[model samples]
Target: MRRPRAETRWAYVFLLPWLIGLVVFQAGPMVASLVLSFTDYDLIDSPRFAGLGNYAKMAQDPKVARAVGNTVLYTLSHVPLAIVLALALALVLNRVTGRAAGVFRTIFYLPSMTPYVAVGVLFLFLLNGQAGMVNQFLGLFGVQGPQWTTDPDWVLPGIVLMSLWNLGSTTIILFAALRNVPKELTEAAMIDGAGPWQRLRAVTLPMISSALFFVVIINTITSLQMFDQVYTMFFGNQIAQQSSGDAALFYVVYLFQQGFQFLHMGYASALAWLLFAVIAVITLVQVRVGRRLVYYEAEEHAG
Candidate 1:
């Protein structure tokens, strides 16, 4: 007990930098933003108290509804597709080993490491309606592709497709999870006359449920917070004017426009807080649901 005090002191010493950084950089900004959410403050002028005015204005703001709708739609479309694709890639990669696995892993992960700005720019040409690679490939099969950037019906789907480029991290995580499943359990299941599908359904999925849960939450968050690619591709200086109406006006994008372009810092902060609230509620619900779904080997061990 006496020695624990000295050990705890050293632990705190080691943790001091991280604690300081969290308070200074993260917690500080969050608190400041919270306060700013209730006040009017352009970058030029001092903050003026507005109480719930900024938030109340959001109720009547048509753009807020549009932004939220677009974001939710994108999240719905992107999160499941990303997870399924990542899981599929992981399952394929899980069967391989040695140098071949390493090469494939690197190849899949390289696209994710590419900057979103570059991805956005590259995709512009790839998704172009007139003479893009994707259209050319589709044309080979007697199918014509839609104008990805211009048409309202196809614009959001294009964004969702673009979002898949960064599923490499999710794939790697699921791959690691798949590799961690106990071979003995699988072998036992096989001995019991379980077919490939049965064994996978009963053993593999439950074993990796925790990872799937994690990927779902993370991908959902990423989908909701999508900004970089959208901005770089559709909302840029020379491109925004050509965008097909409100199909791509995600919540964060609208927040950026309000805060920077229109100088509505208070309104932007309010929007940020609203998004935070939404994410918090959704995460809480997911956690509640996941508690029953996620299989924990540790819990079984402890029992």
Candidate 2:
């Protein structure tokens, strides 16, 4: 049953590049970062051993606390909304076929494919307080539009809206998952006099639950790491100082401020590790909870 020596050698040869890359690129930096997390390495000076000083400071840092709250708020606001909206769009798209379906799918995905920087800039113009297109359009309706990017009450909402603009990919994934559901099952449910809502609840939902679970998990992780949009749109403005108010001061933004702007590399490293741990725990919890609901077609097939 053993493989020939030549085949074993070929297998090793095929894996050699990946092994080398792992050691040199991934493994090396990961170990280095772990060590750096425990030291004061401000990029300009020699790294000094700090043991747990960075973590201790993080515990008392107001900015860290604010960032954590903002991140949680952003995730709560965006993740569920994105998933639901994407799934709904996907469900609608699933009923269509041929060129129309393709056209609609491409249209939905175009926003996601657009550069984040471009999206940020576009939103900045659209959401501008006085001269922006959105406010101007609202003015015609006799409704006064608040300052979206500038007003504290509206900044987070603006950020959430901007984030949802890129739900096209999620929509496509959900559409594919919906399409993969067996037509025979749906037909059988229909023959049983099941209504549209009943069929969706009993048949469609359970079948696509796994994909839904995956989309939620992915959205949670991505929302936590939101940076480019906030940075490009809001950073270096009066809003940055308004962290006490409606500022979208997310965790990664605070980490960036600590590492580069404030030159607190060791503290930033600790924050990074803490974020990693938090994400790991959340992901594990999601998987555990998801086990109760996720349905695998392969398992059904095997059963």
Candidate 3:
């Protein structure tokens, strides 16, 4: 069943473009960035070796601490809610056995496909302090709407809400996972006099744990890199001096400010490395924890 040498050569030839691209574009830049992280490299001047200066400064940087805190807060607030909401929607859609379900799925997914800038703009207008639709709706009930973008206390919540608006993709992913759950298992549970909740707890959920874990990992990675919405909504003149109590100041946004806005390329590279480290640790932890929960029908098949 082994390939001939000629076939193997052809396979490698086909992969040559990607291999070359990795070296030239991906690997080259990554290595360069690592090197740059150790130096003080302003765009206008040659990089000077500074060893751990950038990292040392990071430990003492108030802005970096604030950005990290905000990012963590946003992730903790948004990811769990998004996962639950998406899974609930997906479960509902999975039970619908007609064209209506398909239409509804597409409608839900449409927002995720829409451009981030458009979503940011739409939310900004919708959540505007005095004139926004959300506030106006609240006014009808005599409940004053908080300044979502401008008030520090409300800024992170606004960003978390905005992030939830694109939960369609997660819903679709969970829907697919739910569909793959074997119906016979649920029927067996029902035959044992199990109710709906019992069936789901004993059968459906365990079957889809792998997919759920995957979604959590993907969401964590995405949340750590959140930038476009914050940049589009609050960067520069749009950001009031003390907007949202600085709640919207995410880690990636701070990195962007350091590298592009402040021209602290070296420092930004260090921050990028730190972000990578955090993500790596988190992913490892997820994998370890998931090992206990993830189930595979293939294992039963093999056994």
Candidate 4:
């Protein structure tokens, strides 16, 4: 006990820099932002307390509603598709062996490592309506691809499709989870005359449920906060124009325009807080759901 306690004290000493950095950076900004949420302040002017006035304006702001709607739609379209695709790829890769599998894994993962700006630019070129690869391919079948980024109807779908390029990390995580699943348990299930689907449902899924939960939560949070790709592809050079119409105005993009462009700092702070509340609630709900569905081997061992 004495030795462990001494080691624990040493651990704290080693962790001091990180703990201090968190307080100075993350916690400090969060508290400042919360305080700013109640105050009306342009960057130049002194902050004046507005209480809940900024938050109250949210209900009346049609643009806020539009941005939120766009964000929700994007999140709904992207998250499930990404998860399903990643899992399917992982399952396929898990069945392969040796150098060929390694080559394929590296090939798939390279896209995720590519810079977001480069990916956005690549997608824009590929999805362009006139001379783009996608439209040209569609023309071969007597069809036409929509102007992906320009047309409001197709912009969200284009963004979602672009987002899939980075599913490599998710695939790698699920692949690791699949590998960690006990082969003995699978063999036992097979010996009991379980079919492929039955074995997957009974043994495979439950064992990897924790990893699935983790991926879902992470993807949910990421999808909700999406901004960079939308900006890079649509709004990067057009800050003054506020172009891209209703389809491209994601929640974070709107918040950026408010705080920086329009200089509505107070309202922007309120929007940030609202986003935080939404993320917190969704994460809490997911955790509660996960408790019922996620199988933790540590819990089994403890029991």
Candidate 5:
């Protein structure tokens, strides 16, 4: 069946604004960047056609390797911790109901709404070595804290801790997914003498596996793009030099330095496209594995 021409025209008319915005905002800049990636443009004069020079330079750049390693390490450290903590919060939130549930949910979510710059500053203060709040707390237990901001060994871990401060959104998402699980399934498992751990393993987790998968993918991308917190806390700070700034030199931050700080516009564009490709490939792999692991209610019904 086909819609009437007048109705179809109205639908397109309603979508016109968004379509125009996409062409102008998203597609246009992407095309321009793609063209720029093949040239040598330093934000002044004409873009010299350099062919594959930018990519070749990127391939041989040691900073690029360091940035990629730091990003991967951060992602590994943060993603699992975020997923576990978020799921734990979701489980706790799942046990509450009514007004109390809403209050707790709002409390858990507020941190995610905090400005990244402020969060970075707060974390820097808290994680400071000698007299900061975190070390001060640790000192109560007769432990001396490492210099998180000035020591290379602890700096990356400290940044990971900072990133975990904004897990409210992930918790809320997992909490919603947990809520959607049918109570009947868990009750049946309980009736069969399944313990709390057994029920969680057999029923709760499988039911929420899709949400876990989503959180993993989203966290991977977000971790890869971490910049504002790092820049706010480390970039230009003298302590960062002592801390081995390479440990915090994440991919997106390096790209920003190239494009804006050093004015390597063309090289930055190439790096941007390479990052895009890496993300796309990784997402594809996750989706491939997810097909085997994710339990879909619709698929069960269809089968």
Candidate 6:
């Protein structure tokens, strides 16, 4: 039987605001950016159609390559570490209960709510080269700490360290997943002579695989777009100096410079599209690979 027209009309009425926002704000700009990527628009002048010229330039751009390399390195360094740390925190918290667990959970999550700019500035002071708190602490043990913000070799690591502070959100998600996992499986595994590590590997991991997959995907996307922390800590308002800013010039940072600072709107649009393509491909690969690993409890019940 066909649904009544009046009811169908009311559903569309309720969805109108979202539909309008999607078209006007999200989908509209995506389409416009794709078209603009083929042109040479400097925001002031008219966009002259340059066909594939922008893409050809990107192919030979050394800075583009550097930016992409930096982004990939940052993603690799931060994502896996963040996931592991978050999962470990979740596991620890899973064993706790009552008022103490609530207090601990809030303490852990508080850092995630701190503004990125504030955290960046705070870390710059903490990780200072000579007079910083970090180096001073290291000096107590006679270990000289490297210049975190200024040195190229240590800048990425510094950023990764800051990234760890935001693991509260990931930990909460994984903690919920751990709670949902069937305890009977782990109990049975223990009864069969499985040790703690073996039970964790065989039972707990498979049960929470879906949550693990979600964390991996989310972290990958966020790490690739890391800009605010680097901007505040390394490049805000100051002239770009090779010793300090070069190491922190991430893909989004470069794109921001090209679009707003340099006024190369067309080139920036191309960069945006290229990043979009990369993200699309990575997400697709994750979904493909996830098919073999991520387990759904509903599917098990159905089987």
Put down candidate 3 lDDT per residue, 173-242, tens digits, no spaces.
Answer: 9999899988898888989999988987889889988888999999999999999877778874355535
In angstroms, the error of model 3 at 185 is: 1.4
Ranking by lDDT: 5, 1, 6, 4, 3, 2
TM of each candidate vs. truth? 0.95, 0.92, 0.95, 0.92, 0.97, 0.96
- Give the lowest summed-lDDT range of ten residues in model 2: 237-246
Give one digit per residue, the lDDT tens place, for model 1 in 1-303.
989999999999999999999999999999999999999999889999999999999999999999999999999989888888998899999988889999999988889899999999888888888898988999999998999988889989989988899989999999999999999999999999999899889999999999999999988888889999988888883564366688888899999999999999988999999999999999999999999999999998999
lDDT of 5 by residue, 265-302 (tens): 99999999999999999999999999999999988999
Candidate 2 local accuracy as lDDT?
A: 0.88
Which pairs clash (backbone N, Cα, C closer than 3 Å) in model 4? none
lDDT of 2 by residue, 230-281 (tens): 8878874554345425277889988998889988788888888899899999
Point out where model 4 deviates above 4 Å.
1-10, 237-243
- Between candidates 5 and 6, name the one with more favorable TM-score: 5
Provide the global lDDT of candidate 5 against the true structure. Answer: 0.93
lDDT comparison, 1 vs 4, better candidate: 1
Deviation in angstroms for 245 in model 4?
Answer: 1.1
In model 5, residue pairs whose N, Cα or C atoms come closer than 3 Å (at least 3 residues apart or on different chains), thus clashing, are: none
Supply the TM-score for candidate 1.
0.95
Instruction: Estimate the overall C-alpha local distance difference test score of candidate 6.
Output: 0.91
Most lDDT-accurate candidate: 5
lDDT, each prediction: 0.92, 0.88, 0.88, 0.90, 0.93, 0.91
In model 6, where is the ten-residue run with the lowest total lDDT?
Answer: 237-246
- TM-score of model 5 relative to the true fold? 0.97
